[model samples]
Structures are given as structure tokens and as C-alpha cells.
Target: MRKKLIEAIKAAFLSEGYGFFQGFADKIQGSELTLPALWLTPIEVAGMSGRNDGKVTYKIVLYLFVQNEQYDEQQKEEKWEELERIARKGIATLPMISDVISTDKVTIKPDEFAFTSFGELSQTVTFLADVYFCNE
Candidate 1:
């Protein structure tokens, strides 16, 4: 289920024209975290939605990773900001999600980000987009 949510978000990002990439844990075992070794990029534009109150709601959230060992604290912060900006730009360039209610952007320490579940993350996406995108 968690994997599915991650994939859904990745798909959403791809649909928005941003490259959705994933790096598997196995490939990061010994190599420096400086560069991503196992990355998965989505090939299509897609949206994930759930039905609520007789309506379909679409939303997405993404977890971007940067190697802490390779970047200083300031660099990590900058990278996150940059990534978020890029994500927003990507979304802005794409066709609007007529079904979305709202959207949100969150930044957390790497450890906190690592501990979040895919479902929880997905819920955040739903809430953010729904609150803003949905027109009551």
C-alpha cells in the first residue's frame, strides 16, 4: 500500500513534466550518498485520487533525497528549497488539476522525512491539494 502511494506520487510528478526518480536501498550500501545510483523515473503523466463525499479528489506529495554525508547542513537546506521550487514550477506549468482541492509543500529534517509512511504522506498530499483546489 505504501509502495503504491509512492508510485502514485511519482506518477503525478511525471505527469507534471518533472522527472520522477527513485533510488533503491541496495545500490546505496557502500557507495557515497553523493550521487543517486538506483533511480526510477516515471514515463507518464498520471494522478492519484480518492473518493470522498461523492467526489473524486486528486493530490500528490514527493520525498526528495540528498545524501547528508555529501552536503553540509546549509547545502541540504538549499537543496530541499530548490527541489520544492522546482516541483512547484513543474506543477504550475502543467494543466491545472480541476479536481484538486488544495496543495501543500513541507520540509523536514532528513531523519523525519525518512520516518514518514507513504500512506501518511499521501494523506498530506490529499489534504493540501483538496483544501486549496476544491471549490465548495
Candidate 2:
């Protein structure tokens, strides 16, 4: 199920011609992320419980890490907003899952967005995009 979500998210980003990004990623997917890249990982899954009548609800926590070069707090703040915008756009761009799944009750939204600096030019922003869906 996690893999399916990852593939779907990756496909959506590709279809939208998004910038450097990865799904099902543990660390940087490629060399240094080019200073402006996005990473998606399913950090956790909520307890699953529901009816056995061919439908099940699932909740997933997908962490999105966006990195950009920032020299100071002001720059970090500016880029954090941009990263938030990008993250939301990416989530909105996600295509519907397979036909077997029912998204009628599904919802996707940003749980949180944060900014931190690693070094003089290495500033990173992270956010959690919570995904809720139903599948058989």
C-alpha cells in the first residue's frame, strides 16, 4: 500500500513537471538534491480498523523535505513559504489512486511546515502531508 502511494505521488509530480523530488525516499534520492529538491517518505501509518465489507480506511503520514540554499533567517523564511506553496501544489497535483479505491471520503492536507538550517548555504524545510483514503 505504501509503495502504491509512493508510485502514485511520483507519477503525479512527473506529470506536473515538478522539480527535483522523490517518493519512497529515505535520504537524498540523488546527488545533493541540486539544492532545490523534494523528498517524500511515509513516516508512519495510523491504526487500521473498519468494516470488512470490502472497504478499509487508511491514514498515512508523508513527510516532505524541501531543501534550498539560504544564507540567513530571512532567506530561510522566504524559502519556507515557497516550499509550503510547492508542497501544497504537489499534494493537489496527486492523481486519484486505482479504481479499486474510493476517494470519496479521502482528504489530503498539510499537517505542518518547518524550516531549519544545516550550514551557511544549506537550509532545509520540512512539512507533513497527511493522506487519508479508502481502499478495498
Candidate 3:
């Protein structure tokens, strides 16, 4: 699962012409920066109450470790927003699993973002997708 998620991310980056995986050989070379190890932290999932009504939603958190000094606060924020957009776009392209299940982006904090799923199959697919994309 992690492999798939990673692969998907790498593919997305490559598709966007970043080529970080291919250019550096052993490092991640962003368009305006570079890093030795751009660590993608473990993925996490949780269930929470929904806003529309009395319901539950599944949330998945995926983390990426950009070196502390690589980018300034403003740059980091901009990069985060870009990455979030990319992630959301990628998830939107995935086929629907069930009528009741839906996904959306959630903000955990200034530096943390989550892709949330609502409904019965939400947890299962979200977990599988996180692993799949992160690992592939």
C-alpha cells in the first residue's frame, strides 16, 4: 500500500516535469531546491464525526519530511499548498467505491493535511490507497 502511494506520488511528480526521482539518482531535486532524503512519513487513518449530519468519516494523513532548512516558512507553505492540490487531484481521479463513500481534504494544522473518506468502505479504501500510492 505504501509502495503504491509513493509510486503514484512519484509518477505525479514526474508527470508534472519535476523529475526529482530520476534526476538526482540518490536525492530529491525540487525545481527550486534539493534534499538528500525527502522522507515520506507513515500514513495514518482515523474515524471522525461529519459536518453535514450525525455521521462518521475516515481520515487519512500522509506526511512528507522536507528538510528543515530547505525552504523558508513562506516557501514551505506554498509548497505544501501545491502538494495538497496535487494530492487532491490524484484522489479525485480514482474511481468511486460506493455511493455513500466520499473523499475530501482536511486541515489538521498549518503543516498537516489529510484526505478524508466518509462511509463504510472509506477506511478500507483510504488505507489501501495510502499504502499503495506511498509504496508503489
| Candidate 2: tens digits of C-alpha lDDT, residues 40-105 | 544344444444433333443343344445436786666556556655565555435432243222
What RMSD does each model have against the real structure? 9.6, 6.4, 13.2
- Candidate 1 per-residue lDDT, tens place, 8-106, comes to 445555554544445443342333332211123222223444343332323343344433445656876676665555456544433343333344443
Clash number by candidate, in order = 15, 0, 18
Q: After superposition, how far is residue 49 of candidate 3 from its true place, in Å?
A: 16
Span of 10 residues, lowest total lDDT, candidate 2: 119-128
Identify the runs in model 2 with alpha carbons over 4 angstroms from their true place: 15-32, 54-67, 95-136
For candidate 2, the per-residue lDDT at 74 reads 82
TM-score of 1: 0.38
- TM-scores, in order shown? 0.38, 0.49, 0.34
Model 3 residue 114 CA deviation (Å) reads: 17
In model 1, which regions exceed 4 Å deviation?
Answer: 1-12, 15-54, 67-69, 93-127, 130-136
- TM-score, prediction 2: 0.49
Which 10 consecutive residues of model 1 have the lowest summed lDDT?
Answer: 118-127
